[model samples]
Target: MQPSLLTSNASHRQYRGPITTAIFDWAGTVLDFGCIAPVEAFRQVFSDAGVPITIAEARAPMGAAKREHIALILKEADVQARWQAHTGHASNEADVDALYKEFLRVDEINVAKYADLIPGALDTIAHLRARGIAVGSTTGYPREVMKNLIPLAAERNYKPDFVSTVSDVARGRPFPDMILANALALATPDVRGAVVVDDSPTGLLAGLASGMWAVGIAASGNEVGLSLAEWTALSPAEQQAHLTPARAKLERTGAHFVIDTIADLPAVIDAIEALLAAGERP
Candidate 1:
């Protein structure tokens, strides 16, 4: 259900960067804990390679383009040592491809199975649109997933003005290609008029690199390492209870604002307006 807003005489203060458009990340940020399903798939491929990793451990590299994140994980986890112990062999390019294929399969199937908008997310998007802002979305989700999910999104009437995929970008998150593409689509006179809302390091990096204001969604059920089921089981109250720590953690990520939920979005917008009115950049 959409959030109800009572009409009031209060003025809608315009801010220099009150975010005329918002770009969203698909999986973990908007589409509910999508990283975990792909983790299970990667586990299968890695098991065949004689390396086993927990789904929890596997959620760490979210918001990055898969291949880029996998390369990062391989180096960080000393995959060479793991490979030596597991199969007395070094990791190969072919292993990466095999794991990638498995990961993509899980991502594809689970896009429908698990794709619920984050609580308050739809309402927040609606509120932004109601205020005359364009809403755009970009995702690490490849075009194949978009083929199914875009139709689903349209069925729900939460459609965005523009959508871009990681596959369409030269470099994905942490490089700003997808965010930049979405910003170009928004086409506002000032780049600051749009904001990127994200929950991961790579996403924040992308927003900052794109030179757009960034808001970090730091809701409780979305702490860095939780799986989908764990997040879903938390009641809204419980989720709100967890937001404090998430906010603190994300503050270090350099976001202009750290919001516990999309419900807090209006307040953040007000803050941005205050900043702009004072001739300060947010």
Candidate 2:
């Protein structure tokens, strides 16, 4: 028999109670939908290193620890070819190291300026909190960057019960390390009860692999310069033309549900509640 796509049985080996916590990804999921700061900073860093990468390309490493993310991009198949094409230079570990430092500095300084709470983000968070659901935040950003944003996020009336960094955990997305950490921090004993909301495919896989509810918020205004609907409306060929890299990620890490904005979270919550009512997993 074919395996059921929606029902999670194996991953959630330990049957637990309903989900009472929600794990939120920082950049595209909550704070800023477009991820303006890191994307622009990475582009500049790459340009300075003689390899000009677009903001879209720079976001490939998102949802993973900073160093691991950097390594992924530096070792990408097109690393040498793209570098040669854009900058007429060959990139090595030393070049990657220099780019890393510049990117970090720019990220630290620029993150604050890019803080736009995604539409309905704060409202959804508030709604969950009011319902006694604990909200926790985890990001591929290092501690410095997360700490820098706390004050800003607080000013906007959105605060996470636990704020953690990717470095705080052993591994990053596509592995359940960060989600596990957030679960522990939130004291959520049941995986089914916790919801993981993210915009990255890796992040969605991480949550799903951890047996938590994964909600993919494919929001518009991505630094990639196209709205989510705009990207989706194109012909399959056109869509593939624009999102080859992102599509590769998605194909590898399929999400349970795809949504265009945080505004659509009510439907997600309704589904989770229904699952709970049915006693399927949660």
Candidate 3:
């Protein structure tokens, strides 16, 4: 079912409190260095369907609901044309279903492998919690995948107070449902005072749509598309090649702030609090 949209009037209300909640995306924003699990799953699923997609193409729809991600790619003109050329027919819901099934199967097995917490993620969440901010999470992964991820992440000392998955909401990122769900779970009274941190355009848009401050993490995510080690190995000039475009895209999508990684988040939070003090509202 589609979630009821928050009325425009509701979104415009001013709130006077400090930020009480910080909702984050899972893979790219906090764990799974390089955000490689889903990307690899996308590649494998499409290639298995005889329609291979480039990494850029696979990453294009990152942060959407899994099935919707597949559908979005199919809707792309180039991807559609390629699908027809490969299969001798137009792609349809059936094709999406097949691809999504394969993706889920592949991802279920591989997600845990990439579940290592991104450096600074645990510390950042702990810092936020220590400041009396409630830590919550939203993710593109469904319940089944999260069933594995949640425990793994907790074992490594990186657990949020609440987790809202795609299955927990009617719609996923680019929509506000998941973020709103987090607010509901965190028992936050005002959405505007919460912060949403993510690494994808859709996730940023979701935060903006929810009238929350949106911070985009650039390097440690899909946009930069490099593992921590891989990113560190790149020459400064080479790294700029990735950071420039990724930061631009996130900004274009209305991210309030685009920083390098979650390690910089505390300062960003301080900046946000300062803005709130000055009567700013997201």
Candidate 4:
């Protein structure tokens, strides 16, 4: 006999009721409508180095840590060729480090230019707070950049309880570190009772990896590459073209929901709560 190993039932505690906390990504999701800061900074830094990467290339690695993002861009075939042609050598770690240093200098001054709180962010955050849902934020930006962006956001009436950044943890997006840092700082009793809302695939992936529900922003974020007014000005058919693919991209990241902007977040929150009450786990 195997000592009746199957006789004992394993039991574990779980939370099933309502979302107690919500974690948001900064740019594109809440503060910056189109996630413009990093993109502009990336493009400027590359151009200054004489590599001159295109906007599409600048945006392709939107949610990664800044230095890692630069490295990813350097790995691209087109960018690599351009770098070699311009510098007489293939891009290397030192080039990445140099570009990243420039990016820090540029973005620290540039982020404020795009810091307008996305329309409805304040209201949506207020709605969550009203229901006793603790709000926290995470970002791909480093601490110094966040120090600039956070106050700009606060002045606009949106302030998250805890702010986590790439610089605060060893790894950033597509990793669970920052989101888990938020969970810890916000003191979410159970990770399952938390929801993460972001505008990038990497950010959403990080949330799911942390065992939390993940939501994505489609039309208002990097995927669509448009501000609120620019998005609204598009013809429905035109809007559909960019939006369908953007939504699909986020869905491919395994998000629990995808909405156009943070404005639509409260409804998603309600839907998630309904599922939670039904004993669902993200």
Worst 10 residues of 2 by lDDT: 219-228
lDDT of 2 by residue, 28-58 (tens): 7786656666777777777777777655567
lDDT by residue (tens digit), candidate 3, 149-198: 89988899887989999998888888999999889888997887899999
State the lDDT of candidate 4 residue by residue for 48-116, as single tens digits: 988898889999998999999999999999999989988899888899999999999999988888888
Comparing 1 with 3 on lDDT, the higher-scoring candidate is 3
Candidates 2 and 3 compared by TM-score, better number: 3
lDDT winner, 1 or 2: 2
Ranking of candidates on lDDT, top first: 4, 3, 2, 1
- List TM-scores for all candidates, in order: 0.82, 0.80, 0.92, 0.95
Against the hidden true structure, what lDDT does model 2 obtain? 0.72
Lowest-lDDT window of 10 residues in candidate 3? 2-11
Q: What is the alpha-carbon lDDT of model 1 when measured against the actual structure?
A: 0.69
- In the range 25-44, model 1's lDDT, one tens digit per residue, is 76656656534545555566
Q: What are the lDDT scores of the predictions, listed in order?
A: 0.69, 0.72, 0.89, 0.90
Between candidates 1 and 4, the one scoring higher on TM-score is: 4
| Candidate 2 residue spans exceeding 4 A from truth | 1-17, 82-90, 221-252
